[model samples]
Target chain A: MLKITNLHANIEDKEILKGINLEINPGEVHAIMGPNGSGKSTLSSVIAGKEEYEMTEGEIIFEGGDLTELDPEERSHKGIFLSFQYPVEIPGVSVTNFMKASLNAHRKANGQEDMPANEMLKMIREKSELLEMDRKFLSRSLNQGFSGGEKKRNEIFQMAMLNPKLAILDETDSGLDIDALKIVANGVNKLKSKDNAVLVITHYQRLLDYIVPDFVHVMLDGKIVKSGTKELAYELEERGYDWIKQEQL
Target chain B: MELKDKLISSFLAFEEAFDVDSDIHEVRSNAIKEFESLGFPSKKEEDWKYTSLNTVLKHDYSVFPKKEDALEYRDIKKYLIHDIDTYKLVFIDGIYSSHLSETTHDKIDVCLMSSALSKSKYKPIIDAYFNKIVPKNGLNSLNTAFSKEGAFIHIHKNKLADKPIQIVNFSTGNESALMVQPRNLIVVDENSQAQIIERHQSLTDHPVFTNSVTEIFAGKRAIVDYYKIQNDRASASLIDNTFVEQQEESVCSMHTFSFGGKLTRNNLNFYQRGERCDSTMKGITIIEDKQHVDHNTLVHHIFPNCESHQDYKGIFDENSTGVFNGKVLVEKEAQKINAFQSNNNILLDDKATINSKPQLEIFADDVKCSHGCTIGQLDEESLFYLRARGIPLKEARALLMYAFANNVLESVRIPELKKRITSQIALKLGVSLGFDL
Candidate 1:
């Protein structure tokens, strides 16, 4: 579903991701675990086409097109989603209206008419129920005065509503408590299908326990040092990332 | 001739037309003398440092427009909040359009200022409140010198106005350049309530200058909401001076929305005369293409336990300019006063300019007074967040601006007016979604 060849990215003069290559097949979930400042978030941002991070020498092929040349909105229209680590607070835009605009924009980009108001409402009701979000939660200003767990859940709620082809969860589990983690994990699990993929980027093994990945890649510096199954997550969590740095050395 | 001299000379003709035996004649004569002394405020004055009336003062304006510049209601319906029923005091070319106006006298006086000044029945109310709170300023004096027209609303003691009063002034461009001075006196009696909306619109591209003065007296426990909508043609310029005096426990708020015009200046002042009085001044300014808007607001806390708030936001594009000068004064005896002032601006283009100054003078040590000012572009992260959700860059920028200007509209008591301001903001931002998001 996605391919990256030697993704070398930099922010300003400092290189963040030196040499990175990865591939994920359809219906697969891949987890990338790294310590702080190890370019884990940078890798996800590069994939999502954040403009500030300059992709110096690389090409990202997703759904038969070079993603590097496209803007973030174009990528969004092509079914690419990035659940932000910190969602922006828009004071006057209600969450339901935000979802409606996003859904309509996607439909318009695909040469389709706007979804009927009733159908949009029905989908919002069903998806919000799946995420255990109260109806009142959808009426508040988008992420304004929301708790940490509420923000993460709202991001996932957006992900569920957009239903993108490739979902990149960047540190989605960092701020969630045990209960919110389970709910978010459950939502992602229910949305997984044979035609879509997800890339889970995290700093701990706690989230992998809830949404088990098909493969685990341990990142050191900027490159992936080891690739294994779910047990690799437990090993790294128990022994810490020092072993990974030693292995790289 | 310069506009200043023309106005001074026209005062004689205006005085000759009115009755010299009337009690207001002395007031008018004194005002004209003051105007002659002060002339038009020069840019060198501290209060007029940022706003220059050079462009407006250079026009050769006709003091009196041609009589009965007829206008059909259908042609100018969109300029009004016509969806709701209101007591409308509409004027065309400085002459009251009786055919289009709905003045009332059953419970409250929502009628023309000319009749209120000439009629003997309303003489007492006029003598008590007329021009009492207004200061001796150049433009204010000029308005008072020619203050023969405008809206006069007087809500009796303990009486509620039947509906909102809308005062609309339209210039038909009958002359090359026409100037109008509208004087409004609103006295909400003790325990009474009222809402007022005033707008100045020009039908043609001919230059129009309006020097308006409004004096509002909120008696004990009265509540008054005043809104000013200045969405005129690019050839129009407006100088609005509104003075509000509040008694004990009264609430008075003024909201100014400046969407269009060449140069618009709002001098809104609030004087809290008694304890527990509240004053609020808020505005939103969005302009482009050499248009300018200036807001100079002052709130004086004279008594103990009073509060005042001032919030002004501006979004400037192209070569448009904006200025916000908010001043709050808490006197020594006014302990426990709470005063706040905030001015935020966004320069959409490189040439856009905004000068924001927040001045606070507090003699009461126990008072809580704060002021904040910020000038910047839209939040990049917020823009990218919307863009990443498949919204186009243009739409994203518009949405951010809409959100930026929406908070100031929250205190709008009238839902229909709120919607109107919301749609105006949307139109200014070039957003397709019409209603609130």
Candidate 2:
């Protein structure tokens, strides 16, 4: 579903992602684990087309299209999703309204008319229930004064609503309690199907236990040096990333 | 002749039509003299530093309309809050349109100032409250000199108004360049409550300048909510002077919504006369093109245990300019006063400008006064967050701006008025979100 070839990226003059390559097939969950400053988040942002990160050299082909030239919203219209690590606090727009605007924009970009209001409400109710979100929570301002758990759940709720072809869960496990982790993982699992793909990026292996991945990749110094299966995540969790660094040296 | 000299010459003809022997005649003569002495405030003055009236004042304005112009009720129907019942005092070219007005005298007096000033029955009310609170300034005196027709509202002691009062002034643009001065007087007796909405609109594209003055007295424990909606044509300009006095435990709140015009300057002042008085001032200004709006407000705490709040937000696009000067004063005798002020502005275009200054003069040791001001672009992180969620950049920017200005709009008590302002804000932002307000 997605392919990256020697992705060379940088923020300003400093190099961040150097010579990285990865591939994920349909319906397969891929996990990318790395230590701090190992370019795990940078890779996800590059895929999502964050403008601040300049790609010096690379090609990202997603679903038979080159995503290198498209902007973030264009990429989103082409079925790319990035769950942000820090959700923005929009003080006046309620979550339901935000979702509606996002959904309509996507539809417009695809040359489709606006979805019916009743259908939109029904989908919101279904997805919000899937994430165990309170009905009242959808009426409050978007992510304004929301707890850590609520923000993470809201991200998954949006992912469920959009149903993107390729979803990049960037640090979705951070700042969430155990119960929230299970709920988010369960929502992701329910949305998984043969037509979509999931790429989980995390620094810890606790999330891997809930949403087990088909493949595990260890990134060090902006390159994925190790690729294995579910057992690899357990091993790394027990031995730590220092062993991988020493082995690479 | 210059516009100032023509106004001086026109004062005589303006006086011959009114009751010259009444008690307000001396007040008018004194005010005309004051206006002659002060002329017009120049840019040299600290308060007028950012907003210059040179361009608007150069027009050879007919001080009064040639004749009372007739307007079809359907043509101007959109300007009124038609969904709800209201006490309307409508004017066309400075003349009260009896056919368009809905005045009452059963429980409260929602009538015209010309009646209150000339009629013997209302003379007592006019004597006790007319021209009592307005400052002796050039523009205010200009309005007082020509204060013949406007809305006059009076609520007796402990009498709550059954409906909101709407004071709307429409200039039909019959003359090439016309100027009108309207004077409004509102008195809420002790323990009474009232809500008022005022608007000034120019129907055509001809040059129209409105110099309006309003005086309000909130008696002990009374409550008053006053709203001013200034959305006029590009050739129109307005200078609004409103003064409010609050007695013991009274509450007075004013909301000014400025959307369109060539130039608009609001000088709103509040004086707390007794203890436990509450004063609130809020405004939202959204203007584009070469439009300009200036809000200068003052709140004076004279007695102990008073509180005041001021929140003003502005969004300027294209070459528009805005100014907010908020002043709060706590006198020596006014102990335990709590005053808060906030002014936030966003410049959508690089050429747009805003001048915000918060002035606090405190002579009391036991007072809590704080002020905050922010002038910047919409946050980049928030923009990216929205855009990444599939919202286009333009829509994202508009949504963020609407959110930024929503706090001030939330205080508008009337839902229909709030919806009107909300839709106006949305139109200004140039985006139609698929959600109700």
In terms of DockQ, the best-performing candidate is 2
**lDDT tens digits, residues B302-414, model 2?**
99999999999999999999999999988999999999999999998999999999999999999999999999999987887888889888888989988898888888898
Q: What would the DockQ be for model 1? A: 0.64
Pull out the clashing pairs in model 2.
none
TM-score of 2: 0.98
Residue A88's lDDT in candidate 2 = 89
Say which docking band candidate 1 falls in: medium
TM-scores, all models, native as reference:
0.99, 0.98
Residues B1-437 of candidate 1: C-alpha lDDT, one tens digit per residue: 77788888888888999999888999999999998898898789988898898988888899988677889999889999999999999999899999999999888889989999999999899888898989998888889889999999999999999788999999999898999999999999999999999999999999999999999999999999999999889999999999999999999999999999999999999999999999999999999999999999999999998889888989999999999989998899999998989999999999999999889888888989999999999988888788788887888898888888878999999999998988888887877642245
* Each prediction's number of clashing residue pairs: 0, 0
Q: Write the per-residue lDDT of candidate 1 for residues A52-150, one digit (tens) a residue.
A: 899889889999889998988899999999999989998888999888888888888999988888898899999999899999999999999999999
lDDT: worst 10-residue window of model 2 chain A: A84-93
The reply for model 1, stretches above 4 Å from the true place, is B434-436
